[model samples]
Target: MSATGVQQVVAEMLQPYLDQEGFELVDVEYVKEGGNRYLRVYVDKEGGIDIDECGRISEYLSDRLDDKDPIPDAYILEVSSPGAERPLKKPEDFRRAVGKDVYITTYEPIGGKKEFEGRLLSYDENELTLNSGKKTDVIPTDKVAGARLAIIF
Candidate 1:
């Protein structure tokens, strides 16, 4: 099956388990690294997730994958937290990130640049405001290609 298909299937299979366990599904990736393929699921919660938690989730999903047999080829299966700089994909993620430092990339230039890194001032449905030092940039929601929490030095 296709990479996106594999990811979507795995995500759907894992959601119920994650929700029951109070874990948030952050992202799912099916990628090739060198000669091997990997299926990685990133999960998180209010405080943080630990090695034991990851191991448990991995074991649970491994069983489900074994039964469903979604992927056509052999691949490594991994489950873990998204870490300190978790990606902001959905609108809810952006809403929760307000007042936090963030890095964003747009599909097209906003304020003559495609990248913006600053404190996320606000995010309404239409646009998001970012304050970078003395300047603030307001970018339309549709323009964002990717966004993530930033660990400022």
Candidate 2:
């Protein structure tokens, strides 16, 4: 099975368990590093998640994967928190991140720059407003290539 196909199967299998546990499914990655293939699930919830929560999720998913037997090759499974710099993958993520500091990269240059790191003042369906120092930049969401929470010192 393809990577995305595997991810879809895993997500579908795990959704019920995650919902019952009050956890939000953040992202899933099926990738390779060195000679090892890995399937990683990023999960989160209000007030953040702890190691025990991750362990439980991991164990449950492990059992489900064993039963489903989706992937034919040997793969490592990992479940963990997305951490402080978690990615903003969905519109809801962007909405919840309003008034927070963030780092964003554009697929194409906006104002001759491809990167913006600042306080996220607002987000609409089409654009985002960011305050970088004294300047506020209005960036179209379509131009965003990547976005994540930023730790401001």
TM-score of each: 0.97, 0.97
lDDT of 1 by residue, 81-152 (tens): 898999999888999999999999999997699999999999988999999987999999988899999998
lDDT tens digits, residue span 1-153, model 2: 999999999999999999999999999999989999999999999999999999999999999999989999899999999999999989999999999999999999888899999999999999999998978999999999999999989
The candidate 1 region of ten consecutive residues with least summed lDDT is: 74-83
* Pairs in steric clash, model 1: none
The C-alpha local distance difference test score for the whole of candidate 1 amounts to: 0.93
Q: What is the C-alpha RMSD of each candidate to the true structure, in Å?
A: 0.9, 0.9
Candidate 2: segments with Cα more than 4 A from true spot: none
Q: Per-model C-alpha lDDT, please?
A: 0.93, 0.95
